[model samples]
Target: MVDWLTVLASGLLSFIVSIASFEVRLRREQSVEESAEVEDWYTETAAHAAEVRRTWQRLWDSPEHPGSNLTEISSQMGLFERQISRHASSGEQLDVDPDVVDALDALAEECRKPSEHSFHSNSNSEFVEFRNDILDAVERVEEHLAEN
Candidate 1:
């Protein structure tokens, strides 16, 4: 006589084991994908930071800045602000260091201030602070990328 109950129970146990195995594989694949995404984000964020720093340096170095309505400079600032903001927000979601995120915010805010014309001259104390802050933020981001 066939032991139907015993066969059914064995089949059920096998099915459960297969399900668990598939779940483990799926989780591992998800983890790998997440890690790759994080790495890509870091690389992109670092590149953006470097670009912002370069653009800001050009703005500060330009002697004709802040006096005339140079559309090109304004456009560059707008792009830099957008990039910084995007990276800053993404970094927050990725649980990047608070200090780094804060620096990013500060840089974006400073870049936005040209619209207000708050600091008319780069020779002023505020200009120095702003310049230093931008450089510092870029350095921090670059260092982080180097370490990873």
Candidate 2:
């Protein structure tokens, strides 16, 4: 009878051990799944950042066109602004730093202001210079976004 009791005890112990092992495996699998999810989020964020940089590059490349309609330019700028706002609102992390956003905002505000018409030859040159400056600011923001 004592031998039979000992055998029963051994079986019970083995059952407990098996249960614990199964639980450990389940926990490990859950952890791996969570890690994979985080990796996917990071990859998606990076892709969004790259897209923002590309848009900035396009804006900078063709800031001033002599023959371009003002309405078209204004529409494009508005679209870019909307895209930036949308991406920032999305779950993806911002590629550009907050400071860059502030700088760009200020530059954009300056560009939006109506220029005082002057007969002076330098007036057009001044406007061109201002546009160039805004483009430069956008480029800087783009570079910062791409680096991240």
Candidate 3:
């Protein structure tokens, strides 16, 4: 009778340990998959932001005809703004750093302002300062995004 009881006890202990091990592995895999998904999202957002930054100054010179240049950059910037808005909302669930969202909002605000002569021969130092601020904000988003 004692031998049968010991066998039953050992079987139960082994089953519990196996289940605990499986649970740990399952949780770890879910974490890894979530991280990969987030990284893909970050890659897309970063690429779009970089493209906007690169083309920002070109809007003034981008027109063959008149008035088209004004619309071109504004349209692109609008798209960029919408992307940031969506990303910020999605990131809220992941507990993304607030700094990332704050910087994104700042970028969206700056972009929404009419492309006020992104650059011109007579543009003052203020233009340079504004451009630098935009760059810094973009970098800040990229930096904070990787932390999550």
Candidate 4:
């Protein structure tokens, strides 16, 4: 006589093992998907940062006097600040070198200070240097992403 109970129990055990194995595989795939999503976000954010830096550089290059429109300058600064804050809030480090941040902050402070004179040679030099620093940071971030 066939041992029906034993066969049924064995079948059940095999089915349970299969289900467990599938569950583990699903979890691993999900983890991989999540990781890819984060990486995509990082790359996109880096690109946006680079674009902003370029825009700032262009604005600085304009013949218009720097302090002529302090309001516009302030608006741009606010936008940059928001961008950095948003990335930080998203749990992604800005990936900008510390030196770059310091240079930018210094430039911002200098802009905020009242100047008796218009754009001096030193002022242009400082602005160019700060812009270059931001570009460098963007390049570093791009390289890091590429390597990963």
Candidate 5:
């Protein structure tokens, strides 16, 4: 009373199910890896922004003895900005806003060519404003990424 066609169909269905499950698991793992990479990039970028702010603070604190690290940090910031731009424009799952990326890029450019007045002044209000703007932009980017 056993039907050979029924047995063959059952076997085929089981194989299909197994392949689908594997595919779902593989996609999930890839998503997690991509998310982790995005997080790492954001962390590194934020750290660089913080360092740039700290360097400006140090310069303001000791206007007569400015360190030579500003150019180096600024260059690093520019690199990060470019990487972020690439990710944002690559049609990837990165939900970052273009405006936020532009803001960060502007900050990087500002850091690269700091105002002489801001550098020599002990108050450094301009630098403070720039730091706050950069932090805000970074926070916005983080928020967007969190939604993914």
Candidate 6:
């Protein structure tokens, strides 16, 4: 009464379905992990930018000579650059937007301006304008990241 061929075919079908389900679940988990990594990277980058801004402000506010903190600011900027580069090159495969890169580049240039004699010696109105430009550039980066 037992049909051997039918039993074998049914067993094969069950095994294939189980394998396919396992693969789908594995891919889904990998996707979630990648997404979380990207989110963390963005959050850290934004915070790093804010920290740079704060340190720059502190340098400007220092009672000591304006150039006193120049070395520290430069170091911080360099570290920030390295952090961005690391994420981009990491095997984790982050999807970086060109617009965000442009925005960050603009911000870095603005950051350097604060240490320049031209910007440092400028009138208060000019200083305010330059500061606003830096803020705008940072906002652009944040907006791009959120959109992506």
lDDT of 3 at 104: 71
List model 3 lDDT by residue over 112-138, tens digit each: 554444645534444445456666777
What RMSD does model 1 have? 3.6
Q: Residue 77: error of model 3 in Å?
A: 1.7
| Model 6: how far residue 15 lies from native, Å | 0.7
Each prediction's whole-model lDDT (CA): 0.69, 0.52, 0.67, 0.55, 0.56, 0.65
Clashing pairs in 5: none
Score residue 107 of candidate 3 by CA lDDT. 75
Worst 10 residues of 3 by lDDT: 60-69
Top candidate by TM-score: 1
Model 6 steric clash pairs: none
Provide the lDDT at 48 for model 2.
Answer: 41
Instruction: Kindly list the per-residue Cα lDDT of model 5 for residues 1-148, writing each as its tens digit.
Output: 9999999999999999999999999999998988787666556545655665565555434567444444444455555555545544442445444554554555554543333222445434554555566556655545544444
- Kindly give the number of clashing pairs for every candidate: 0, 0, 0, 0, 0, 0
Error of 6 at 118 (Å): 14
Error of 1 at 81 (Å): 1.8
Worst ten-residue run, lDDT, model 1?
Answer: 66-75
Error of 4 at 102 (Å): 13
- The residue pairs that clash in candidate 4, if any, are none
TM-score, ranked from best to worst: 1, 6, 3, 4, 5, 2
